[model samples]
Target: SSLTPRPTGGISPIALPVLESLFTGNLQEARKLVFSQMLVSGQAAENGGSNNFIIGKRNQRALQVLSKSVDQDNCKTNALLYGGMHCKDLHRRLESMGYVAKKTEWRTAWSVD
Candidate 1:
C-alpha cells in the first residue's frame, strides 16, 4: 500500500530592522525594510497572517499617520488570512514594524498533547 503524504507548512524567519522601523513610526523606512525582508524571508509569495496581529496594529498606526492611506473596508481574520497577495503585503509590512526581539533558551518539551 502506498503511503499518503501530508502537506508541510512553510516557515520563514522574521526580519528585525523592518519591524523596528514600523514600531518606531518610520513609514518610509518601514516600506524599505518590509520590501527587503520579504525578499530575504524566502517565501515565493506572501502568506497572509504570517504576522497578522502586528500588521493590523501597525496598520492602525499608519492610518493615523496618513488618514487616507487605506480603504475603509473591513474583513474578519479568516478572510484576511486567505485573502491573497495584497493581504500578504499588508501583513508583511505590519509584521516588520511590530515584531519584538527576544532571547530565549529552550529546554526539552513535555507535551500534554
Candidate 2:
C-alpha cells in the first residue's frame, strides 16, 4: 500500500468494513465487498477513506490487539498487522518470511513470496 500515484486500495480497508471483516475471519466475504474498488490513494483519502488504520479509530485498536494475539515468528499476517513504530523491525520480519515490504512515502505493500 503505497501513498504515491499508484493504487493503495486507498479506501476499501478502513473506511469500509473490508479490513475489519478480513481480520475478524471473513476475508472471502470482504473480497466480495471490495471487488473493483482499487484506485489511487489520493482519490480514496479525498473521500475520507484510508488503507492504514486511523490513529484514534477502532481499527487501530483492532490491529494492536491482533498483533499481540498472534505469534510474530510464525505468522506473516501478524507482521503485516503490526502497526508499530519501528520500520527496521518490520523489515527484518519480512526478510525472515521470504517476502519484502515496499514502502512508498505514505504506503506499504508486500511483494509476493
Candidate 3:
C-alpha cells in the first residue's frame, strides 16, 4: 500500500493582502496584489509557457467539492482554505456562485520578532 497526498487548496501565502484589499473595497489593489504575486511566483501567466494548468485543475476540483457541499441542505458553513495567490480567483468563483463573505478572521501562521 502507498500513501499519496493530493492538493486540497491553493498553496500561496500572499493571498492575505489581496483578500484584505478586496474586503476593503479596493478591487484595483487586490488585482495588483495578485498580479504581482503571480510574477514573483514565476508563473508568468501572460506567457503561454506558464504552468498554472496544474493550479487551475486543483482549484477546479476544490471548487466542485465546495459547490456540492454548499448545496447540501444539512451543510450550513464551509471554508475554502487556500493560499493568497489562489484566493482572489477562488473568491471570484465563489462570489459568482452567490457566496457572500460575512467576515474575515486572520490568524498569524508564523511570526518573528
CA lDDT scores, all candidates in order: 0.47, 0.48, 0.66
List runs of model 3 lying over 4 Å from the truth.
1-49
TM-score of each: 0.23, 0.21, 0.49
lDDT of 3 by residue, 54-100 (tens): 56667789999877887765578776787645666677777887878
Instruction: Indicate which candidate wins on lDDT.
Output: 3
Best by TM-score: 3
> lDDT tens digits, residues 1-113, model 1?
12223357322224455556666888888787666566646444434456555556655665344333333433221112222223444556646667332433444322211
Q: Candidate 2 has which clashing residue pairs, if any? A: 1-108, 1-109
True-structure Cα RMSD, model 2:
15.1
So what's the TM-score on candidate 1?
0.23
Supply the TM-score for candidate 2: 0.21
What C-alpha lDDT, on a 0 to 100 scale, does residue 57 get in candidate 3? 66
lDDT for 87 (candidate 2): 42
lDDT, candidate 2, equals 0.48
TM-score of predicted structure 3: 0.49
